[model samples]
Target: MKEDLALMERALTELHPGLYRYNTKEEFARKIADFEAKLNEPLREDRFFLLTAQLLSGIKCGHTYLNPYNQKKEIFERLIGRQTYIPFHFRFIDGFFVITENASEFDLPKGSAITSINGRTVDEIVQGLVSVSTADGDGTTLTRLRSVDLSRENGASYAHFDLYFPIFFPLDRPEFEIEAISYRSKEKVRLKVPAMTKQERTAAMEKKYGKTPGYDEGWSFKFLKDGTGYLKIDNFITWKLSIDYKRFLADSFSRLKEAGATDLIIDIRNSDGGDAGVVTELLRYLHKDPFSCETGIRTFIRTAKADPELLKYASVYDQDLKAALLNGVPKDRYKPAKNGLLEFLNGAVACPETEPYADRFDGDVYLLTGPDNASAAFTLAKRVKEASLATLVGRSTGGNLNGFNGGSYLFFNLPNSGFEFDIPVFAYHPADSSQAKDSGIEPDVNAISTASDAGEAFDRTLDKTLRLIKEKQAR
Candidate 1:
């Protein structure tokens, strides 16, 4: 336990941005010690993992995550039978624990407020669960709740909700003493429901959202009324397709031109970021001038004799750090920071200027953003906002405005517990002071989803942008 904690501290303090980003080193050390004090007796491995997760949540760095994916499945299968699960999933909407979906025997109505679980009030249970959940900058949890795709067809969207509850607050029995207020009848009621299994949950998801549940992963483009081009880029990863992202992008624009599209709407609502370097290709179509947002990047290499293995991973900067590590690196080039992490000589990387595409989009562009926008997605959004390239509509982004901390990652395994986590290396900051510190990029046109917008067939953010565009057309 001590070794694990020591390693964690070393990685965060010496190597990562914890010292630079968070409070003073002394304060962070103290907090770590305080957390360690609670584990007087050695806890079960699973519980210890949970504690670690909770502790890590305090850091609040979006890039740093404790993904216990396989461990979670194993735990669930062991605790309950391979077939047993709680049958119901919930969503927090408008300050209420609304039962959005259930496959249990009991007819638990939708939109019912879950008052309590096993005599514990909803608030108490949520406080415990959410305490372990990590959020970016402001600790605003609204985005976290929305980020969970409760619908099963969306690749275990409810996995977090399911695993954490069962792991943190174990339910031994098949049924819970559920106290819920029905949204329809406005009547208080109690029900005994059967626990569901993995097979059952999957079946339920298919039954609910079988036909085109959610957009498949890739680039999709279509024309709306009046030559309005709608492009929903699910992700930047186009490796699965025969053609690369460049081809897909070019083809998309070609189709738009063929269709005589006058306006474009790029929906990146739940886009949790991807390769930002490739995003410049998309920007080339929109940008009318020479553009570059990356001011400089800082690479922390603590050990002079760094692992040659680390060099296996490449950076956008084409960093050949192995040579520097093998040979004596001159400290004169790098301005030493407060920490002892290997510092790279701060230098600006101006991206190559590209002229507007031959078929460059000359119409109004609207970007749909939300809390799920992080990493490269946030970078694109930031660039859009900075260049006045598009009218952003939706909730604030999940990624920070100032910069990102991801060029490469170093994985560490816990000494005793065998748990592992990744620490992202290289701090990428913006070119200027025009960005917000630790805060996400706010939308140009503020548009939050209303209660009525919840689970509506219509897309609220996109719809809002479309309405505004139409109004402009009418005028």
Candidate 2:
């Protein structure tokens, strides 16, 4: 146990101490001691590892994370263990958990009140859930939920807690009763739900995407007549797969020209994020040279000797210096940097760059966004709006455009406890904006869906986008 504590001290010492400031080092040590004491109780290594991961997740910086903590398949399998999830899809409406779509299992009716989760009221939940401006509060809550897998089996569903918030509440379970009002009668009802395995959940998801123009690699492009286009992107992890985006855009535009297309609607409603390449490519099609988007801060370490206490977590790289700083025998040696290879490798390509477009997109471009449009995708959206290349037509973005500090990924195995945590060491932000981080980019035109449209199977937002295209074409 002493050895583990020493190991933790060594590992954590590599981090910039500005992360958790106290008046003295002894204070930090005491906190660590308290945390260690708690672990001596009910938590196992694996469980502690998850809790540690969740603790790290609280940082909320896009680049900060511990990956391969478990295999990808294993992670998915764990998610499948929960057959039930919060049924209603919510978005922060004037700070309320406004229900957009309520699934039957949630038993909570659409357009109903979401007074509390576990015991934390909606206000309490939203308090810790920052408004980084992506898709409002709904997007904020959902994104946080995804950061750490919270399965019903893990007691997470009923014991609702924010990734960042320390408070814990026991949410009602399958047979548990809760006061909830239905959208139909506006009356309260008690609901019961059943749990299913991961396989069942996957099957259900597969069925959901089976007919929609979805892609296994995670993107979809559908060109419709009347000069309208629909594109659904799942994540912005990389731009290599989207190399054809420019070609597609050009060809689609040409087709639209033939079909007399006057407006383009790009849907990023489900996109989590990718590299900055997509934005670069899209911007190339829209702007001329001398066009460059902001790339946040460039961090660097003052010295290796500054270990544990002084290193303020810079986002820069020094190959030889970094290596030497981390060099040592079994204890002091630094392993490879997690998620820092992109910065470490510098010019080396992590993912293929998207092809630049020679022609700029003209006419009105209506972008449909949600909470899922994050990270690099959010950066792209911010630049688009900054350049006035496109008028954002949907929900707020999920990523912050102003302050962000998550580039270096920190991996830690609790020596005393065997638990682990992944931490992002770098943060960044664009220069020419007053927009704050945690608060996302607001849309120029807001279009949201309601339960009435769902009942009719009508996409009012999509319909509005199409109508706008026609209006542009008519002109």
Q: Identify the candidate with maximal TM-score.
A: 1
Evaluate residue 393 in candidate 2 and report its C-alpha lDDT on the 0 to 100 scale.
76
TM-score of each: 0.84, 0.64
Candidate 1 residue-wise lDDT, 1-475, digit = tens: 8677766776666556533454566767777898688677777765767777776766666666565532345444554334435566666555556666666667666666677777777677677776676555553455556533344434243355565666676767756678887766778988766666666776765676463234345467888866789888766544444556677679888887777777899988767777775568878888877666444444444444444433332122334443554464676655555554555564443456566788778888999888778778877888888789999998888776555567655555665656666566566544453544657888888886543333343467887898989998999
Off by over 4 Å in 2: 1-13, 16-54, 57-60, 65-180, 183-187, 204-218, 239-250, 288-290, 293-356, 406-410, 413-420, 429-438, 448-475
What is each predicted model's overall lDDT from 0 to 1?
A: 0.65, 0.48
> Number of clashes in model 1?
2
TM-score of model 1 vs. true structure: 0.84
- Per-residue alpha-carbon lDDT of candidate 2 for residues 1-475, written as tens digits (9 for 90 to 100): 5455455545554553223311145655664666577666675434444444433343344444434322244433343234434433444444345444433356455555445544555666665443211122222554553322222222222222222223122234532233444556767555453433334433443453342222334555667765365566565555346356656556755565565444667777667665666667666665644464454433322123435322233223444444444552222323233223112223122334344354555556777776556766777778778778776877677766444444444454443543444444443433333444446777877777654443345676677777766666677
Native-to-model Cα distance after best TM-score fit, residue 429 in candidate 1, in Å: 3.3
